[model samples]
Target: DAAKEAIYARLKKSEAGAGAMHFPLDRDAQYFEQLTAERIRTRYVKGFPQRFWWKPDGRRNEALDCRVYAYAALHGLLSMGLNLNKRVEALPPVPASRQSRNDPRPVTAPMTASPRRRRMAISSNYI
Candidate 1:
């Protein structure tokens, strides 16, 4: 319950555009629906009220599950001393001369290594 609450709070913050996370701009209505498919519910069990997450029948909650799993993965990485903010800050800045006049966003150079090599390097860090 605690973990779920924390994840939900982060999600709320992201939805409100007040967090470090943001959903992709291309997500459709169905995606949003699935992302919020579950709700917290309380039921009496053995004369005690137990609060838990619940979703109605026929509702697909894969999006919500994926979000929770992503949050857990981020926490796991942080526990391993992987500082995401520091990593981002360490990225080489894009030169003003390389920026396109039409595009406002600064473009960074692409990785020189192959995708497989990059994957292997990342996996080896935690191995």
Candidate 2:
């Protein structure tokens, strides 16, 4: 897809040098943790001015009298590159039979029962 390719190109541009770019491990449990630390270190080393925006409109902008600049991070670009070859699939819907209990029947008046006889002598019923 054009969109996917565009994103890939931007990411490649953002990281620039081959040695500066990171290769993420797909399906790894510690991938995010490691990637986050690496991104933070890269940004910290590059500082505010040296960093490049990962998106097309992400660069600093200035108007009549106001100026705006966005913070840059390349972990997203690395993530996109790592997942570019994979197809995302939506999770299957939950079955109706597995739904929570929410009984709709109306409640009826409680049934009354006769009280048991107190201190009754042993009778033929007990025998």
Candidate 3:
């Protein structure tokens, strides 16, 4: 409950232009829909209240899940004593030569790793 509240608060603040977080200008309607697919619901179980985010059937919520995971990751980083603001400030500006032509941002090499193959068990019934 607390975590969900915190996430909503941050999102609200950002939407109100009072937060450092910003969304891309190219986000589509479907993206926004997925981002807000879930709603908070409370139910009583054994006289105890249980709160959870609920989504209707056939609704996709990958965006919301990604946001939650991102918030958790940021919380984890802060708990580890990493000053993200300071780290951002300490970074040097990108040189014009290093900047991409299409986007005014520095280009970084794509991360690549060999895919790991997993072993699967076969049942005699299937065979």
Off by over 4 Å in 3: 14-20, 93-127
- What's the CA RMSD for each of the models? 5.4, 26.1, 7.8
Order of quality (TM-score): 1, 3, 2
The reply for model 2, stretches above 4 Å from the true place, is 1-26, 40-48, 52-127
In angstroms, give how far residue 29 of model 3 lies from its true place: 0.8
* Most accurate candidate by TM-score: 1
Give the winner by lDDT: 1
lDDT by residue for model 3 (41-115), tens: 999999999988899999998887888888888889799888867766666776777676467454443323333
Query: TM-score for all predictions?
Result: 0.69, 0.14, 0.65
**Per-residue lDDT over 1-33 for candidate 2, one digit per residue giving the tens place of the 0 to 100 score:** 233333334445655475333333343534333
lDDT of 1 by residue, 12-106 (tens): 76345545456556799998889888899999999999999999999998988888888788889799888767767777876777567565554
* Local error of candidate 2 at residue 47 (angstroms): 12
lDDT of 2 at 34: 29
Q: Candidate 3: lDDT over CA atoms?
A: 0.71
